[model samples]
Structures are given as structure tokens and as C-alpha cells.
Target: MAMVFADPEMLDRLAKSLDSKAGAIPQLKSRASALDAGDHVSGLPAIASWLGDTAKDLRRRANILRSPSESPFDSLAAFGLPPGVAGDPDAGKKFQTELKAILEAQKNGTPQQRAQAVKDYFATLSPAQQAALAATDPLLVGNLDGVPVNVRYAANRITIQTEYTKEAAYLATLKPTDGAYKRTQERVDTLRSFLNPRIKSYEDPKTGQDMKIEVSRQFLVFDPHFGSTADAKSSPFPDGRIAEVVGDLENADNVAFRVPGITNRLDNFNGFTNGGYQLAADPNGNERPDSAVVSWLGYDTPELGDSVDPAKAFAGGAALNAFRQGISVNLKPNAGLDIFAHSYGTLVTSKALQAGLTNVDNVTFMGSPGLGPNINSVADFKMPNTKFFAMRAPGDWVSYTQGHGKDPADFKDITRLGTDGASGHSQYYDPSTGSLANMRRIFYGGDAKPLTFTHTSLDDEQIGAAEAREMVGFLHSKVPPEIVVKMGGDLDAAVQAHFAGRTGVKDLLLEVHSVLGKYNMLDRVPPDEMFGKINDLAGNVAYKQTYKAVKDKGAPDFVAAAAGKAAELASEKLLGAVTWPVVKLLEVDRIANDAKQFGEIIDRGTAEIGGHVRELGTELGREGAQIYNDTKELSEGLFKDGGKVVLELGDTVIRPWNAGQNAADIWKIGDDAKDKIFAKVPDIAGGLNDVKNTVVDKGGDIARSAAETGGKALDKGIDIGKGVVKFFGG
Candidate 1:
């Protein structure tokens, strides 16, 4: 009843014809652009642009036909066979026997051999017969290693829809009180979400209009019921396996697989798939998409309590290797494949790599606990040509554990990526982070070295210096034109001198202070103690620059004239005192004594500062007048009576400070912080404690009392800094 084609050569001819048409579009655009139109004529350029876009789309479609995985028969018609082959009564039996033989070969073969067997068996089937086989057993065809990617996607869609129908029918007969109702409902929701098409919307910057692009998703593997019955019965959890492809897999120039870590399941599939979408989209705003990303949740991941065991990772490795093998065989000849793994997924990826998974172009591991005990170097993996990359955000606690083995980040030959804008265990893939950008670079074969900033290296000092320069640049931009004219534009020389380090903070402070004093605007500057306190509170140069910008603008002084003076003093007293002890605490020999005491000091400081910071936050809110209510609330909740805030702050300061320390005892400080006085307080615990000790040693009871008073003052100063930052829109 259906037309059949005996020749594949016709498809090749059609593709070449389309290519010729596409090649002529630019010349046509040139001819249209050269036409001298009358004043009444318009939009010729727009028409040319449209023609250019059409050409790209035509080439893209033509390339799809040129792909090895796509055949004309796949879309147009079934392959022709002898008349007896179509209607033979024994055809079903013959198909079953062939499938059994292929399955038997796959069961005992190596991954490569299994792929070959599947490919060989499939090569024998006419397109019509293959379609019939897929329709009869969609699950088998959908998950088969050697099936064409498009055919696998179609089969899997059928399987998913069938499962959805069956589950929905079963759910209709159940009440809310039924034991299976909740699980079934969750399953239904996840399936429905997957079935729904993903649409990305954005505003056209040039046109100022909303536009939407429908992102294509293909399910390469989908299993709704994946875990053992006993495991499901023992725990109330959803267990499903999936590998979803985002973008055009068959024709993509590059493909990447994203492997998730702990606590992942079918219910949270959308979140992981969203990561795939981000990676697959063209970063350069191209009309034609060229990358495909796969979110693979193909094995049982451990729960928090069960994560200590490598049993799950080992099992996952086998499944991951098999999936990659399937992809390897199906990918276009010029396409590159990469792997992006996170947390425990890194361990799984390492295991697969060690187990002989090859042909990978790049591999990235983020927030990884460890690769494996035996994988001490890159050579431990079989992927010799693959470029290995690893990243651990400054405050990520996973690096301290080394629970599984050596950290891949510390591996000798691995490239370490920058993690700015990312922190903690789960933010590596966040859209706003440098970590994600670096990962994207690796996927697209771009160099990310320009973005790299390693913790505790000279890079830290460079970052600080760059921030200072940026502040000065901001000041230059904000200086009023009238003020610049009146001052004879000496501000540029002053800024350059500061950037060159020829003029220090104290020099700038004196200049500003003298000028304001001469104008009798001294009254406008906040008191020395308040100005110094605000400067102390500020975290970076931006806050001080905000004050300078406000001063130059001739706005209400609001302590602007004291910015440099206060900054110089704060850096001398607070930074010198706080940073020295931290430096000492990280020393290999002193970690035992100073590190323990430092933890105790932070514990005490947090307890003292927590409630006071909250009160100080409120008091500053009233004094500042223009402070944001949200900022006040943030300050109050920041310490939250000194529970987690102290540890987080300590982590922020200490991670970069001690990043170069490789001693076990230094790492043990983090381990001990999890449960002891230093618990949660990272490297900063010792520094804060040393500050307290320095105060106590210097003046005994009197100095100790002054230290507490200073703490409150510091909190007030910080609030002022926050206000200024907000005011200047820093």
C-alpha cells in the first residue's frame, strides 16, 4: 500500500541540488543590494538578510540528508524487497529468529562487538521490516545499541506514550488513599512534562519584539520502571532511567553527555534536561544550531546515606560505557563527543574511562569528591587523547573529604578551570557562573584559559588589583563634566597614578580630605570612626569607589570624602590582623595548635557577633535613612543567631587563603569543622580567633572589652558600606 524506493542515490542527488541553490543565495543578495531603488522603495536590505537566513536553513537540511545516519527511505518510503518477502506468512518467525541471534551475540560480546552485531543485523532489514519490528516491540528497538538515532527516538516516543496511557488508565481507578496513587501521580506528571515541547523565548534586541524557538528533544533511552522490585518496596522513591538528547543529534557537529550525581530521579528530569538545553543552544547567536547535549540518568544513584559505597558508581560506569558506545557508533564522522560529569558522576565517569571507554574528545568534572582510589593520574583512564578538566569552587566542601580517592582537580595533568560566581556543591552548572562558561568552551572547542583564576595563586592578587582598577575606571566615568573642567581634568592622572601604585590609598585620602577641608565641606564627611568603620565593612574596592563617585557628583557628602582615608586605615588594621593569623593557621607545622584555637575563637566570635549584627543592622537602617529594607532583613538573617553564617563567611575567606596547602592536617581542619568547634567554619576560624587572642594579649581585660566594642562598630561600618553600595548601584 506504501511506495517503496530501491535507490539511495536519488537522495544524494537531491541534497547536491539543494546545496547548489544555497550557494547561489549570496550572489542573489549582492544583486538585490546593488539595485538603485527609487525613494519609494524600501526594505531591500531586509529582503537580502531574509534570503541569507533561508540559504543557511537550506544548507542545514541538505547536510542532514548527507549524514550517514539519515536515509531518504527513513522519511519518504520503505525499502523495496522482492514480492514474496512482503507477504510471506513465515516473515514474523524469521524476524524473531534473527532478533534472537543478534541478542545472543550482544549478551556475551564486548561493547564494540555488541555494537557491530546490532549494526550488522540492522543492515539486513528493509526499512519496512524495521518499522514493523519497531512497532511490534518499541521498547527493544528504542534501546537497541545499533538502531539509527532517529529511529530509536521514534521508537522511544512510542514506548513513552504507551507507558503514559497505561499509567493514566490505572490511576483513574485509584483513590487518594490507595497505596500506589501518589507514586503513579508523580510518574504521570514526569511523563507529561517530558511529552510537552520545550519552547525558549527571548526578546529580539534589534526588533524589540518577543520571539520563541521550539527546542527539539529526543529520548534515546527511556525506562519508566527501572529499579529492582525489592529496592522499590523497601523505599518510597521513584527510580527511572533516561538519556535525553537536546538539539539535532544526527546532524550536530558536536555532542556532549551530561551525567548527574546524587539524589537524581525521573521526577527531577526537567531540571537536568534544562542543563542540556543550555549546552546545546548556540552560544554565539547563530541561526543554525550545531551542538547536541544529552542528559544521561542511566543508572541507580545512591541516596545521601548510601553514597559512601562505590557499588552504585561501579554499576553506573558499566551502563554509561554502554550508552557512550551506542552514541559513538551513531555520531557523524566529524562530530566530537564530550562528557560533563558532576559530584559522584565524576567517579562514575572515571570508572567508565578506566574500563576502556574511548574516542572521547573532552571530559570535565566539577564538584567531584574523587575519581577513584586507583586513578591517581590521567593515565589511569584509557582515553589517552581526551583533554581532562576539573573544577572545585572556592568554598566547595567536597574537596576536603577525598572520600572516594584523590581529587581529580589535584591530578597532575588535568586542567583546572575557574569557578568564579559558583560556590558550594551544586552550582557548577548554574548559568551565571564562570564554571558553566568554561564547560561551554570545552564543548565548543574554544580556549577558556583567559577566564581561568585559580585559588591561592598570584591570580588572587591579580583579581584584587583588577577590581581596584575597575573601581578607578568607574570613578573616571562618573566624574561630572563641570567638575572635570573646573579641576582641569587632573582626575585621570590621579586615577592612573593610583593604578600604577605610585600614589597609595593614603595619598588619595589626603588629597580628597585637604580639598574638602579647604572648601569647609569637612562637616559633610562622616566622623573619622564612622568613616573608618564603613570602609572596614566594605568587602571590595567597589564600595569605596561608590563613595568617591558620590563625592565627585557633588551629591550629599555622606562620608564620601573619607573613602580613601578610611580604606587605608581599615586595610592596615583589619586586614593585617585578620589575614596574618589565617596565613599562620594554614602552615603545615602550626595547623595543630593555631588551627584548633582558631576554630574555638570563631565559635566564640560568631556567638558574640550574631545577635549584635542583627541589632546593628536595624540601627544602621534608621541612621542611613535610604537603606533598603531587604538589605536590612538580609543583614539580620545573615547571621541568624550565629548558626551557619559564621561557617559560610569563614569558608569564603579561608578557601582562597589556604588553597595551596596540600597537607593532610590542613584538609583535616575542614573535616573537623563538620562536627567540632570549627565545624562549618572553614579556614577563617583560626584567623578570627587569632584576632581575639591578639587583642587579649595586647591589653588584657581592657583590650578584650575594646575588642567587643569594636565588633559592634565593625557591624555598623559594614551596614554603612552596604548602604553606599546600594545608593551608587554598585
Candidate 2:
């Protein structure tokens, strides 16, 4: 049967004509009443009464034409179809015809208009009617934006099952050698995978235990075509666009759309969906089980070469914006919406934002090359209340390319998070990483303090210090408590005095070099060898000055005096071989050897620390210079404030250094590096304990300070440009 719709414009015109005719009835009735009074005609009164009744009927008919029935069935009732038409055999066909007509009328309308039309049309259908329509024309209702999500889920499931059966049957009829058989089989398998719920396993970050989560699969947009010529050749993908939700989107408190980038296809849908599962998982650390994640492969992602083009991103952005609109309307009240975009997907998201995508609470870009060439600032995006966040893990060189625009990490409006446990471009969603943890915090609407990028030097210094402490603790375990009590006291004091003397030597040498450099006395030094030469000259000067100072104060060298005492003891033992001096001489020799080994260990540890510090300084210096060059016109104050933060955090290194030293001091009594007694030394342990407490307290202070400083800078509207002053420590 052909579909037909009543022309709303024609009805409107007819209503107006009837209303105009009805308006002249009152004048006609008045003229008739006057004529009856003058002529004394009894029948004129009846005529006037008849004219008035006719006018009321005309007005009633016009009202009906002006306001059509909200329900399609009601509209059909005026055409002689009863409300009980559901019992009639032809009613389903009639209803479908009318619904199709309504849909056709809205075909040329805007997306929102069409959506509203679909929403209103569905509101008139009974549950049984809806189910029947979904069963008969699954494709029509499945991809419609304004259809209820639950209904769409049902319709899409039927579509999936139908496509799977068709492909599977077609494949079985073809021989293995047939060119189409493999692709058909692959499609069948892909469709079949979505038929059942999937169980995913992830590690709970807080408890460090493996946990399992099961998620229902709902395909909002599923196209089984693999872009074979037999299918639609004009389709963008070799495999069709897909969007799979990992949980109940309608009921979820939080919904995150995961947009992937580059080389994504139906073949990788399951892998992409795994990221959705990770987002949906609610570990005990931050329990938010009422969450859903959508793996939205709604566009043909570009391959590596095609990634440089913005055409795909722009097109994908339009589709994503429409899809998000559908989601926004169907979502439960007060449910938060967020976008987790990666790589080129960040570009896609930026385009969507430019296209007026709204209602997003947060947007996170991980390892993004750029937003786009056109996106110069956060103001370019239409989202007003949305919080923007970005992260680039160490060695994620893709983000540094800045191929699209400014790196998001360098965008002042974007809050940069740490990626400490993640690496490269793909590990942002890894459960063990701080990147994922911060993502969860944002998704769950928790308090997420921005984590600073870990400076390489600080990380290296901590690692070295930890290793040194562990070695010291092991040496302490090998030492006999009795031996340490008998001879360790004097050795400990000598070691402390030696460390104190060496501490000022390095500082004094550095000070002398700085003075020379300031006065241009080192101008003739070759740039390549300047540092080595300066260290040599400065060290010699420092040594002479220190010798003079020591002589003036008559200070004794504790380590040398200890060695001299040992020699005297050995000489006395040689004269009294049968006496206690023999045993004493052995103890003295052993103590000297242990002390020498301790000094060597400290030297190696400090040297490693110094190397790391130098590397860190060089890297930071380059970064600071780059920042200065980038933001010289924006704000010098930002660069200065950032430098202050770095210097303040640099003070944290002393805590670990002190811990290492205390561990060494009490553990220096072993006869050899390996053979030693395990005993707890209270004084050294107490000192180490103090350092540990201080480190924790200082770390908290740094976090608070960074947060405060960052907040203040943002509040002051600092135009950071490409020079981002990241808050470090937390």
C-alpha cells in the first residue's frame, strides 16, 4: 500500500476559510432579528436560531482541522477507523503506513526536528505496537536517534541476529575457494560476538587484586557490511561503522564515549570495547558501578598516512555530535557525559566541540598530536562548563609533533595530568598507570588533584637512593651486634666527621666556578671542555683555601687520625704477640677495611645521584628556555612562578639522601661486605624513620602548594600560550 500524509498547510488554510465564514454569522443573525421585528414574521426567529447553530458547528469543524490528533490511531479514527482497529487483521499495515508518512514528512527537517517527531510519534504507540514495529522493521527504528535506547537496543539486536544468519547461510552455500566466503564468515563471526554479554578482568588498583566485571553489549549503530562491492561501495569503511555500549546507558550515572583513532575497524572492535570495560569497571578504590562506556567507532578512522588530513576528522566530528545528541536526550537525568579521546580522536573531538557539541562534563585527550590547526584555544570549542584535561606519557613523542595545533599539554586552559606508570602512546588506559587512575577520578566525578610530570632526575635520584638504602640494610644484617658495640662507636663518629668535611668541598668548588664565570675570568676556556677545566681549577683553589682554614683552626682529620690509631695498635701487637694486642690488631685491620668499603659505597651512591641531578638540570633548563621563548609575550611571571615550584620540590631530594646516609652509618660494622650480623640499631633507625615521616609531610605540602598556585594562576586568567606551567609533585 502507498503511504499518504495529510498536508498540514492545506488543513491550516481550510481552517482559516471556515473561521472567516463563521465570523459573518453574527451580522447575518442580527439583520434577520431586525427584519423579523419590522415585518412581524414568526418564521424569521427560527431562521436566525438555525443560522447561529450552523455557525457554531462550522467553528467546531475548523478547530478540529487546525489541531490534528497527537495519536496516529486517533487521526485514523476520523477516517472511519475504530479505536479497536488493533483487533483488525489489516491494522498493523495501516499503522505502519501512517508512521512511515509521519517519518517521511520530517525527512527534510533538521536532526533535532526529526528527533522530536520520532519521539512524539513513539509516544502514541502501545508497548505491543512498538514491539511489533521493531520486529518488522528493525533497521528503521534501530538507528533512529529519538527512539528510546532500550527499544533501539532491541531493534539493533534483531538486526544483528538477522545479518548474522544471512551471512552465515550465504557463506555455507559458497565453496571455500570462493572470494566472498572468508569476508562473509568474518562478518558472521563479528555479528555473533555481540549476541552475548562479555566478561572482562582488570586489576583493582587499591587492593592490587584481579577482579571480574560482566557488561551487557548494546549496539547502537551496527552495520555488517565489510565494504565489498556486493555491499555498499560508497561506505567509508572496509568494515562498517559501529558503536557498542558496555553497560546500561539509560540508567548509568556516568557515560563516557571512547573515541579511538587511526587504523580502527570492525576487526579491532573487541579490543576497542575492552577499553570501554576498563572505564566501566568499578574497583573498590573508587566504586562507581553505575557507569557505562561506549566504544564509538562511528566513523572511518584514518590510516597512518591519511591521519594528517583533517577531512576525516571533520566528517567524523559531525557524526559524533549527532550521536551525542541522541545520547544526551536518552540519558537518565543528571547523568554526566564525558569524552575520552585518544590520538587523532582528540582532533575529531575538537571538531565536534567546534560544531557546537554541548552537555559534556569533561573531555580527556591522551597522547594527542593536536586539537587541529584551527583550534587555537579553549575558547574555540563551544563547550562552556566542560573541564578539559590532557596527558602525554614520558617518551610519547606523538604528542610533541604539534601537527594539528598547539600541544594540548601546553594549552593553559587544559589541566595536564601525570602519566607516571604509563609509557608510549597506547598505555593511557592501562590499569596500573596513574593516567587511568586520574581518568577514573574525572569520570567518577571525584576530587582529582592534578598530578605533575615526574622529572627524570628526581625519579633517578629516588631509585639510586632506594638501592643504596637496601644495600646498607643488607650490610647491617651481616654485622654482629657484639662487634658493632665493641668497636663501631668510634668508627661511626669518624665517618660522620668525614662526610661533613666533604660536604662543603663540593659546594665551595661550585661557588668558586660561579664567581669566575661571573667575572669573565673563564672567557678563554673552550666551550666543549670548559666545565671539566673549571672543575679542576675550582677544586684546586677550594683545597688550598680549606687547608689554610683547617690549619688556622688547628682542626684534626678524624678519618686519618682513626687510621693512625689502628697502625699504633698493630705495632704494639707485634711487640706483644702473646698479649691482647694480637687480637686488638686484627680487629683494627678489619675495622679499617670495613670503613674503606663504606666510603667507597657512599662515593658511588653520591656520584650516581649527582649524575642524575645534572641530567635533570639540563633537561629542565632546556624546558625553561623553551617556555621563555614561547611565552615571552604572554607572561614572564608564569615562567618565574613555575621555576619557583621546581626549586621548591627540589628540596625533597634531601630527605632520601638523609635516609641513605643514616642507613649507612649504623650498618658500617660488618667484617666484610657480605658476612655480617642482623641487628636493629635504634639511633639510625630513628633517624631514618624521621626522614620517612618528613618525606610524606613534605609531599603533601608540595601537592597543596601546587594546587593553590595553579588555581591562582588560572583564576588570574594567565595567558600561558604554548608555555604551560605545569604544577609538579602531586
Candidate 3:
């Protein structure tokens, strides 16, 4: 039947508009029957409903052409209908007309009545008619709550295929500036992303022509304009995927309805579907009759930058009914129902609950900011016998933002599922997480005990700190003490190797950090704690370059010579705020002033060695390295105050020649080749020899002892990066 314009003014305008084009068709205007009765052309119903408002309004402005319902119009501007559907005007009208009867029947009905009326109408459709409708306006039929679950699934898939065809064609014609072009492109890209991964397995890349992978989950809802309704006005075009179910919703014994959070779209639809599918398959093999997990993107999620309005959920809040009704349609008498709400999805779910959910037994919320103002208690939801469950991963960062309201988990009544550090806001569905285990248990009307993972309430903590602590606890829990011990031993070996000239210690820092990053520990650990542990465990100063022998005739001269050589180099900066005295004492320019300060400390060390019958530099030994190395306090005095190791013993190596009063008696400081000549002080020659021997045994061992340890440190340092990359994926 032709639609009657309700406004008298609109009716008059339409009549004149049709009359203006009267000259083109001679016989139709003179028909004795009413316009609605005789308007059918070429076996099609009247084209008035098919002629969209856009073209109809255009006719009022000027001359416009109308086409027969059965004939394709070549000149009409693009409309929402597919080109095939638009051209073949009778294409989906039969289905549309049948559905319209229900819509008309429920027009003045209450919300509940309207919903029931739609469902009843669907119950009366024949299988052939249902199939036709699924092929025609599948988006409408599939998402409508009253439709049977299997029918909804079929309709949605058809809708997706059709939309994919239309959008693919539209993409080829879009210009850079076309309205919603980016959105259209994104829609296409998202669909491709989902479809591309469905190839389960392929021949090995090296052996086969191409590698293959599998599409693991079934996508149930892929509408781009789900939350958008045009009751009074138009909505944005090319909005994204409203939902995707990983399994068949119509035939399963258990159903999980998942709600997504902010900034999700069709592009992100598949990325998020794994959680739902994984939950179904995780602890329990898909052995049970569980139907499928529904990833409900049924609402418009605000961008992160948008203000956190509790009412923001109202946009797609009605989807909760869709969720409730879907399960009602196809679920068996004994089937179970579970709803999982995540992030901003909690807000939408909360609103749905407030309106009263039916046929739902368990409603679980994870990573919820809040429940919104209206729902203070589970009773506020008014879901009589329905139980509420909330689970926040011990380390999920989303817990810090309470935009929705107070968390459901906090209430004694709402069961909070426990999760470990491995599951962040996005990882709730990963099989590796405890949360997934709990979700699976709850879905089957069973009990799940949550891990007592530590968590900082959002109240006295910043998001970073809360995550950091969770990380510390989570990582500590995941890595067994034995592993840490083994790692610690490896790090110690690395330090030894670095000092022995096998590898650099600097690489150790980067490698360990990379490992933590691979573990996703970087987001959870505090910078200080992370760096501190890395420094303490893996970081060590390689004294290979710092320790050196000073050759001199006697112990006193060897000590002075070592100190003099130390004074010959410029100041060197080490890790943190540390600087060795060799860096300060070795400056050739500052040697004169530097020596006086270093000389006093040298006297103290030499005095200590002098009393102990230390050696002269017979064979430049580690004793000589330690002899001057011991003058840390004096060396520190020479370095600037800001140095971290002002007086720390990160001694540098420099050789000094003692050009005493007798040039013949001079000794080359660092060279073991330098012949010691303390003939002028032969009285202590025996003592000098003894000291030299002691120094040779001790100091030499410290300086260039074994490179074996350094080789290990070096190998470990290099392996750290490789190990972590491999751990995450190389």
C-alpha cells in the first residue's frame, strides 16, 4: 500500500509534485481506480514506498522522475539499499511487507508489547519466508530480539555478505573527500581483517606455495549501524560492527553475551571476539552443548577523549534487550545464560539491568569503571533472582577509571572473579589467564574460586602505581623462585664474564629490560623497581679497564706511580651518578692540584701497605691495581660532587712512570716490562720483593685473571634479547 503522508500540507505537496510529471505518463493519470489500488507496475507493488524520501523530496523542489517498481532506475542518487535491491524494486518488498505488518500491529503497543508482538510475528513466518527475509533485510531481522536465534544468525550472515558486496563496490568509487569515506574504508578493512585469518592451517611456508591459518571464531553480528536508530532523524553512516558471535547462538545449551568498551567498531570486532570464543573453549573443551559467545558491540562507544557520562550507555543500552531476547528465542529449556561486561560495557549492561533483564541467570562484569549512578546495589538492577558477578584482573589498568559508577565486585553480593597479572583489560578471555578459567566455570552453573592476587583499590592509587604493584605481584607469582634463582646466577655469571672481557654489561641492561617488556612486565612494574632490580641483578661494573698495575722499584713508589698515572686521564663518568677518581685524578691538566689531594690518600694507602711489607712493582700485579684502587676516598675528592660513586671503588687503570731524582731509577707505571730500581733504598729490598710477590699473586688475579666468567656474561647479555623476543614471538 502507498504510504499516506500524515500532514495535509505534505499530501497536497505530493499530489502537485506527482501532477507536475503527469505529462510523461499519459494513461496512468486517467485510471478510474484509486492511486494505491492501481499503482502496481510490472507485477510489483506500488513504488511509493520504494521511491525513497530523498527522491520524493527532490520531486517537490523541481522536475523529478519516478520509475516503475519492477524496473531499475539508472539515474537515482545512491541510497541505503544495495544497487541490486534498489533496481529490482520488488527484491525484498515481500519480506519487508510481511515484517511491516508486525511493525504496524505493534505501532501503538508498549515497549514490552511491541517486543513480544515482533517475536510473535516471527513465530508465524514459514521457513521459506524466514529464509527470504534473512536474504533481504537480514540486518533488521537478524538483530531484532523476537526473531529465532538460528534465523537471526542466518540473517546477520547474509546481511554481512550483502554489505560487504555493496561496500566493496562503494570503495572503488569513493574520493578522498567523500563523506564517511574513512569510515567506509575502515569498515571494509575491518571485514577483511576478520575474514583473512579464518584459514585454519596451511602447508609450511617453506614447503607450500603459501602459508595458511585458521579463522577460529564464528562472527554472528557485523552490522555497521547497530546502535543508530532513525526514528526522528538520520544517523551517521557507516558506523561499525555491533556484534560477533563465535559459535551458533541458536543451538547451544549455554550462551555468553559479551559487551565491549570504548572506541570499538567492526574493525575491532574480531580482535575482541577471541575473548568470547576462548571463554567457551578454554577450561572446558567445546565438548558441552554451549551455543556460542556473543561479542555485543551493540552500542555506540564513546572515544577515550569523550567525557565520561554515566548516561552515555543509553545510546546502545537497549541492546541488553536484544541480548536477553536472543537467548530466549533459541536456547533450550535447560540452557544457561551469562553476560560478560567489560570496560565501558559495564555502563551499558548496568542500564540494561536497571530496565530489568529476563531469562538471565548470571550477569558478570569485568574491568568495569562503575555501574552508573542509578545502580547502587544489585537490587537496583531489579533482576529478581539473577546473580551478578564482577571480575577485575589483578593488573588490569581499566580498573582505575570508575567512570561507570561503583564496581559490582565491591558489593558483597556480586561475585568477583579473580585474575592474575597476565590478564590485563584486554586479556580477560585469554586461555592463559585465571579469569578465563573462572568465566568457563560460571557459564556451566558451577563454582569458580578466584586467585587472591593483590590489587590496590583505585581510591588511594594512581593507575600506574596500581598496575605497577599488580605487576610486581603477578610477575613474582608467574616466575617461580627457582627460575629467579637461576636467572640471578646467570646474571652473576654475566658480570664475571664482562669483567673478563667476554661481553659488555651495558647490553645486559637493555636485554633484561626487553625481557620484562616481552613479559608485559614493563606496564606493571614501577620504573624505579624495575630498574633497581635490573641494576642489582644484571648490572655490574666491568673492572677490566679500571684495574691496572703500576711498575716501580718499591711498594711506596709503585703506589705513587699508579696514583700519578691515574692522574693522567680525564674524568670518566660511569653508570648512575658515579665517577671514579682515576677519571678525576688522571687529568693531565689537573695532575698538579689533583695529586696533592690524591697524594694524601696515596700516603694513607701506601702507609698501610708500607707497614705490611708490600711489594715494589716486580711484576705489575693486582696488588698495584688495589694499592691505588684503595685510595677511593682521595680519588672521590678529585671527582665532582655529583658523581654517584664519589668514593666508590670503581677504580680506573692508568700507568704512571716514577721519574725520581735518579733518571736511571725510573719505572714505567703500567708496564710490567719496567725494571724496578729502588737501589737507593736497598735496605728494604727483601721487603719490596716479598710485597711484590704478594701483589703479583693477589692483584694480578683481580685484573686480567680469567676471561671465562666474562665470556658467560657476554653470551647471556646477547641471549637476553633473543630469549625475550623468542618468548614473545620472533
Best by lDDT: 1
Candidate 2, residue 357: lDDT: 87
The candidate, 1 or 2, that scores higher on lDDT is: 1
Tens digit of per-residue lDDT, candidate 3, span 1-730? 0101123344447666655444334355345234655544432223333434434564542331111111112111111112333334355668678788887877776555665676677677665555556556666776676666556555555555556666667777877565445556666655544432232222343564333333323444556665432111111343465666655566777788888887665644656665665765634233233456777777667554342544458755676765565446445657777888888888888777666566678888888777875677787776777877788765455665454456666665666666654455777776556777677777765455533433445422322434343444445655654444444434443443343344576866655544443333322343334444433322211221122223223446557555544433322122323422222321221223223333444455455444434333433454344444434433443343324222222222122233232233222221212122232224244445656677666565443322433443444344444334433334
Per-residue CA lDDT of candidate 1, range 1-730, in tens? 0111122244445545655665665566666567843332345446555655665665554443222232222321222222223234444456656886888857877766777677778789876666655555667777877777766776666677667667667778878765556656766766655554445544577895666654434788888678532123222344778888866787888889999887677766776666776665444333225778889999887655456567789899999998887666677888989999989999999888877688789999887878877888887785677888888876566654565677787777888888878877878777667887787778877554554746443123222333433333333344533443333223434443454345798887666544433322212222332233334444455445556676778766756746655655656577656654443332222223233334445566666555455544554444343324434443444344344535545665768564344334444544544444332233334434554554444335444544865664565445445434433434
Candidate 1 wrong stretches, greater than 4 Å: 1-96, 173-183, 200-216, 228-238, 284-288, 447-451, 456-730
Error at 226, model 1, angstroms: 1.9
- Per-residue lDDT of candidate 2, residues 168-198 (tens digit): 6666787766545455565555655665434
- What RMSD does each model have against the real structure? 29.1, 38.6, 32.4
Worst 10 residues of 1 by lDDT: 1-10
How many pairs of residues collide in each model? 3, 6, 35
Clashes of 2: 6
1 or 3, greater by TM-score: 1
Query: Which regions in candidate 2 have their CA more than 4 angstroms from the true location?
Result: 1-95, 169-187, 200-216, 226-237, 284-287, 447-730
lDDT of 3 at 266: 66
Q: How much lDDT does each candidate structure score? A: 0.61, 0.59, 0.52
Ranking by lDDT: 1, 2, 3
